[model samples]
Target: MGMMFPTSLIGLSFDRFWKLKCLSSMGFQSLTSLEYLWIKSCPSLTSFPEGGLPSLLLHLSIEGCQKLEKVCKRDKGKEWSKFANIPCVEINGKFIYDPDSHSD
Candidate 1:
């Protein structure tokens, strides 16, 4: 978590956000209250943080992120499971991965 916020942050969106090359492993694992996250037009983005995202996150969308290759691996990496319970996940205007269906 690069910056600590009050335990009340519910939604966050990054539109055309530049300068940051990556969003993962920046301490998002500490955002216990975060429910929604939207990232758009971040062309420089490449991948997620190694530690993974917060557990409370329910919604995630990534659009126009041309450089972003993979949002965590399919079912191997530690960060992969962090997104396993999310209800909605959209990438580039398409609903590709479904985390809930991979549950145990």
Candidate 2:
């Protein structure tokens, strides 16, 4: 995957970033400056890698990815467990079920 930062980007409070049919299986990583990410119609993308983004990420949108089952799976002793407090994450435009939730 090509790793090149766009030249026009400055004062990076990006409200939206869209990638369609171009993102590889690797997925975009380390976009710490991005606020909202829109990934659509990328069928090959199955799962986001563990520890994929900066902790500052606020909004994430995933849609039309039929093959994706989970956004990020918890790997024991991995940073995926730390995302419980990241504020907002949506899968297929629906709120994700908190893996940490329990029934009593």
Candidate 3:
């Protein structure tokens, strides 16, 4: 969980990154090409970076993050809008929020 790589990283997945508490503000921001991201079982992760997720992220799934409350406030803003175009999002084995389903 404490590593850095090229900014060209297209896809990243963190499975059982136990020690990661809070994601860096610039973590996903710099990964402009990141499309798929999956995080699982990082029990210490309480929340997301204040800046929000990457703009090009198409798929995101997180599970077993018991401390996490919300990805972002449910509202019209930069943080919320980041997920507006995402095709798929799943949390804790369930799809809590879906753009296609909520559009109606």
Candidate 4:
């Protein structure tokens, strides 16, 4: 994804990208209208983009990406800052950040 995704896109998913390793922050930031993103089965992925995910991102789902999940475990994660603001986040079917359970 090189800032070429349709701006009208609101949801996106990355599935079974076995060779995918990392993504560029700027590339995702350009998705100004993006709301939800899901990634699965990319075992080699270990990190998020450099700066952070788009502020408009409302939901995030990650599965089967053990290395990346380990690096994004709530506040203790090295990439926590990138996900702290997303209202919804699910890792391996676990709710890491759930708006329904969050209190102020």
The best candidate by lDDT is 4
**For model 2, how does the per-residue alpha-carbon lDDT over 38-62 read when each residue is reduced to its tens digit?**
5566665654545554456576656
Q: Candidate 1 residues 13-79, lDDT tens each?
A: 8898776687755457667899998989888777666666777888888888766635444556344
* Count of clashing pairs, candidate 1: 3
Candidate with maximal TM-score: 4
Model 1 ranges with Cα > 4 A deviation: 69-82, 97-104
Q: In order, what lDDT does every prediction score?
A: 0.70, 0.48, 0.69, 0.84
TM-score of each: 0.72, 0.53, 0.72, 0.87
Candidate 1 clashing pairs, residues 3+ apart or interchain: 1-27, 24-49, 25-49
Candidate 4 lowest-lDDT run of ten: 95-104
Q: Residue 27 of model 3: what lDDT?
A: 64
lDDT for position 6 in model 1: 62
Colliding residue pairs in candidate 3 = none
Ranking by lDDT: 4, 1, 3, 2
lDDT of 4 by residue, 1-104 (tens): 55567777899899988888897776786688989999999998988889888889999999999889888877888988987999889888878766553332
Cα deviation in Å at residue 85, candidate 2? Answer: 4.4
